[model samples]
Target: MAAVFLKLDRFALRQFNTAKYAGTRIFFDPDTFESKVNEYYGERHALETEFGDRPALVQGYAPFCRHLFMPNFTGAKVSVQRITAENESLLRTRYEARRPNELPVLVRFFPSEALGGESALPVARYLDVILYSREQCLKEAQAMGEEPPLEDAPWRIISIKAQDEPYETPMQPITIMRNSLIGEGGSGVPLCRKKYAEAVAYWRERAIIT
Candidate 1:
């Protein structure tokens, strides 16, 4: 099975387990979660609309581009979520034990710190706090490396892992628009353009535009 890339946005993630001062926030309307899976199948644009302004979601574009542009690269199904530490642990354990033949697991992290100031609150600041806390967590994890509880999972950590290598920022407009048109045939081109126009108009109206 292809790997399922779990993409989490800042608004969906909670604060670090041990970081009392940092908290995460979601960017989409909370109500969207009530019927995400169902609506996603019927109207894929709904998902793009939900992710449009999120910088974290935008970051996925670079990896996606590599997958699309590179030869012989297998594609992956992208899924989004907002989960707590306990939920993450539970999911990881289940996937590892089951080793389901259908799909590979690729968990991506979206820190609130990356959301920047385009959002309503101090998203970037909160992310910085979370990062600081995460650094501490990593140090502890490294120290406990050989301990029974410190065993690491086998999943490939990409799309969200902290790395020193330089990466070109993904092109948000092209990715969202192009992905929206997938499977729609030629008619989607005009429709995508219209949607882009509407997005521009909406941004102009809010003046809170991306």
Candidate 2:
């Protein structure tokens, strides 16, 4: 069965209507539509392809870029309670220690929403995060002995393991984003080894690991 994805944007969900579903909120066969939306958002921001050939969907809880405004991402955004100035500084330090020039974006809590459409099977919410430059992410993928990222590809979605903390830093020498779980649809788990297994088991228990 084709994967079913829930549209989590609370403000406006017009973008998720990839198939022109006559006002349909849910989407079927989201592969092409996801690619197109990611591409549109990438180009809208004039995002440079520094990492991979092009921008790819960042399927995660955080809104890594403008294209991703779903409830899951937005809900996490709302859940981020204000941190103490000292703790905030420390987290910033931890992030900057890895990426000297970049900062990590924090997202919190996953959304609890039903999949409304033909495939109403507890759909997971996906948010697209854009890693503008593919240099570091691609290199890490290669070091894992995975195929080098395709040349000049339109976009590449980076995945990571889910975490209670929604903060994400750019891919750097330590590799904030690593390649995990090679799948048939070029799928991967973006989390580090620490959380990869946990994410897999969680999804499997819920029968969401497709």
**lDDT top scorer:** 2
lDDT of 1 by residue, 1-210 (tens): 222222222212331122211213223333332133223222433444686532322222222222101111111111122344533432321111112222322223333223332233222211110111222223323443421222132111112211111233222233235434423211022235655565554332221111
Candidate 2's error at 49, in angstroms? 17
- What does candidate 2's lDDT look like per residue over 1-210, in tens digits? 322222222112332434321111333334554444444554534543654433333444323222232223221111111234433332221112112223342322111221222333232243333332244335445544555554453333332111233244222212224233222111243656545555544432231111
**Against the correct fold, how does model 1 do in TM-score?**
0.18
lDDT at position 2, candidate 2: 24
Summed backbone clashes in each candidate are 4, 20
What TM-score quantifies how close candidate 2 is to the native fold? 0.29
Model number with the top TM-score: 2
In terms of lDDT, the poorest run of 10 residues in model 1 is: 68-77
Which parts of model 2 have CA positions greater than 4 angstroms off? 1-31, 42-67, 70-126, 130-132, 153-155, 160-210
